[model samples]
Target: MKQLLVFIRKEFYHVFRDRRTLLILFGLPTAQILLFGFALSSEVKNINLAVVDFAHDQATQHIIGKLQASRYFHLQQAPLSYAAMETAFRQGKIKAALVFPANFSADLGHTGRGQLQIVADGSDPNTASTITTYLTAIVGDYQRQLNQAAGALPFQIVPETRLLYNPEMNGSLNFIPGVLALVLMIVCTTLTSVSIVREKERGTMEVLLVSPFRPLLVLIAKAVPYLVLSLLDFTLILLLSVFVLDVEIRGSVMLLYGVSTVFIVACLSLGLLISNVTASQQVAMLVSMMGMMLPTLLFTGFMFPLENLPGPLRLIPNLLPSHWYYLVVKAVMLKGLGFGAVWRETLILLGMSVALLGISLRNFNIRLA
Candidate 1:
């Protein structure tokens, strides 16, 4: 009994002696809880909206005023043409566009009806769809207001909602792409982090550092085996998602794989960054879990919709590599989108990979120096 007690005390002492390990152990739960608690919201807010009102009438102006007054939407300058609106969406300047057709007031007064168009950016189908829903509800409210004032329901506003790409909403189809992202993140970040730290703990890292191999070559050699294994895992995931789960890939398979390859390299670079900072396998494991797993799963739109997150909290996912990967995967897999549709996200991931790899290599060189 005394021996067991003594061993347990010794283990606790060893664990507490490492300041990095101690910080992670104590800080992880607090940080994760705060982050997830604040970031996860059921309400969507701060949607950027553009209005194209060809009607130029009281009714159209009133509707535009209401949209601007709403807390959910931030109205931009009215677009002069459809081309301008498309450019805005492609440039990510707006999530939705409200178009009031010519003689909107005339149609409403004479025919008791008018057409309102809601064009949403389908790159993020979930967010775009939600924006349309909100616009529809607003128009309905306006119609109800007219009926109450006139003492009869005389006017109707018809909303033509065009959800580009994902005309048919499939929840499973959306999730399958996200699953690929999460799996790759786990394979690359967690496993590579632990393996690299294992070398450090085993004193093998010192021998490698002293050897004739260049630092970049040494890091690349260590990463090659893991990269191949991660690719194999990615292939298996793709097959399972398509066959067993019955999720169809509508886009170019080569494009999907190409984007995934870049993301894996980014995740691997992130792991190397963690491994470089950590001294032990245990610290690496904790850092990978606390830093990579929680944020990627909860905040990266992998398991939760980004639209539902709080306003300030929404910015965090943009920094995560998995966030862009999730967007690209969903766009390609569910929508059959080509490279042109997802080039922005692809470029962002590529940039993240290059930046993280550079930082990791610099840190490695410093450590050796």
Candidate 2:
């Protein structure tokens, strides 16, 4: 029993002596609590909207003016045609479109009723649904004002809400892409971290360090297998999502895979960075799980909307690789968007991959020195 106690004390002493391990051991849960507490929110605000006023009448103008007054929406464009509205939506400019038919004023004046068409880009079903509700409330308020002025029965505004893309509003469709993000996080960070640290623990890393190959080459070779494996895992998840889960991939599969490749590279690079800083497999695993997985789950806007989070917290998600990757996946998979639709997100992921890889290589060199 004394021998066992001594062994346990020695283990604790070793863990405490490694400053990085100690920091990770204490920092992970604190960070997770704070991140999850602050960042995960469901509210929507500041949605972009477009207007098409065919009537060009007082009532149409009044409705449009009311929408502009609301904090919930920002009027981005006034396109002349529905085609233009569709183009804007496909290009990811506007979330919703408000169309007033030619007879808007005439119908309202004659029958105490008006018709408004609310078209929402249903790629993001939650945001689209919220925008529709907001517009409906705003239009209803306008109708009430009309009735109050005339001292008559309540006027009615019929909202024809069209949800483009995802008319069904399937929750699973959104969830599957996020699941991919989590899987990638595990593969790139957790697996790679463990693999590299295992090599170090077994003295294989020391052997490679003395070999002719550069440290960067060794790190890259270590990452390539995981990169390929992560892609394979992504493909498997995608197939299962499509077949078993019945989630459709609306965009170009090739583009989705291409962007996914970039994200995988970024995540693997992040793992390399972790492995460089950590000396033990246990420490590497802890850092990867807590540092990478927790943030990917909470801060990436996978399960929660970043718009709803507090102002400073909103900026944090932008720095996470999974946030941009999830955006790209969601836009392409749900909206059927192509490269043109998601160039910004793709570029961000590409930039992150390069930056992280460069930093990891630098850290590797420093450790060698």
Candidate 3:
């Protein structure tokens, strides 16, 4: 028993001595708690809402003011015309829009009834559903308040809620894009990193480097097979999504594949960067899983509304390639958006792939020396 106790104490000392071990033991759990606590919220806040009040009447202005003051929404600069509102939605500027027809207040005053059109972006069904419900509740509350005051007539504000992009609100639509991002990243990054590390472990990597071929060419050659394999994986996922899940690729199939190729290249480049930095398979897996995988899972907006996250945490998703890829997939697959809608996201992914590949090649040069 005494010997066992001494051995346990020695093991504890060894654990504390290794910074990486200490981090895995303590830091990882703490970080998970902080991130999950903030990021996994169901209650969506800070919704960007656009209001078009054609009535310019007291009742319409009052409701707009209430929406502006509500914790749930940030009333965007009111779009002047229907054309402007459509433009905002297409550009992904606002999550929901409210439109009050002309003579809105007069109809409410005389007939004790009113009509309001509420338009929600339904690409993310959950957020769209929640915002519509919340907005309806707010409008209902105003009607209730009027009825309670001065023994007024029963006032009714009927909201005609229309869900754009996904009228049926099929939950599958939301997860398909997210799954593509998650699966491709995990498979490509883990497989590529593990494969390269395996080469290093088996001593073949040094053999390949010693050849007369350029180091960059060798690196690309090593990555090429995995790149092709990852694309095949993507193809399989797309087929499953289309047939099994019945989620149609609304945009051009060529455009979808084109954007996905960019994303896959970015993920492959990331894996190369990981392989170059880590000497062992264990370290590479840890970095790939804990470092790359966690960010991809958490920062990708499909898992939750980005608005729920705090200010500093919000910036994390912007830095992640998976997040951008997820957005591009949603725009193309769900919204039927053309390349014009997704050019910015595609450009960013292309830039990241180039930068990561460049760095990995530089690291290989240093290793060769």
Report the lDDT tens digits of candidate 3 across residue range 114-170. Answer: 898999999999999999987887787677667777465544343434342223445
lDDT of each: 0.76, 0.76, 0.75
**Per-residue lDDT tens digits of candidate 1, residues 1-369?**
453444345434544575653444334333433333234433456899999999898998889888888888999988999999999989999989999889788988887778888999888787777788888878876887776777655444434443421324334455566666766776678767776777778887788678654556656765765576567767776676666555678999999889999999998998899988898888888898788888888977757678998889989988999989999988998889999999999999999999998898788753544
Residue 50, model 1: lDDT of 96
Off by over 4 Å in 2: 1-168, 365-369
What TM-score does candidate 2 reach? 0.56
Which residue pairs collide, candidate 2?
Answer: none
Error of 2 at 116 (Å): 32
What TM-score does candidate 1 reach? 0.55
lDDT (Cα, 0-100) at 205 in candidate 1: 71
Order the candidates by TM-score, highest first. Answer: 3, 2, 1
- Report the Cα lDDT for residue 178, model 2: 72
> What is the model-wide C-alpha lDDT for candidate 3?
0.75
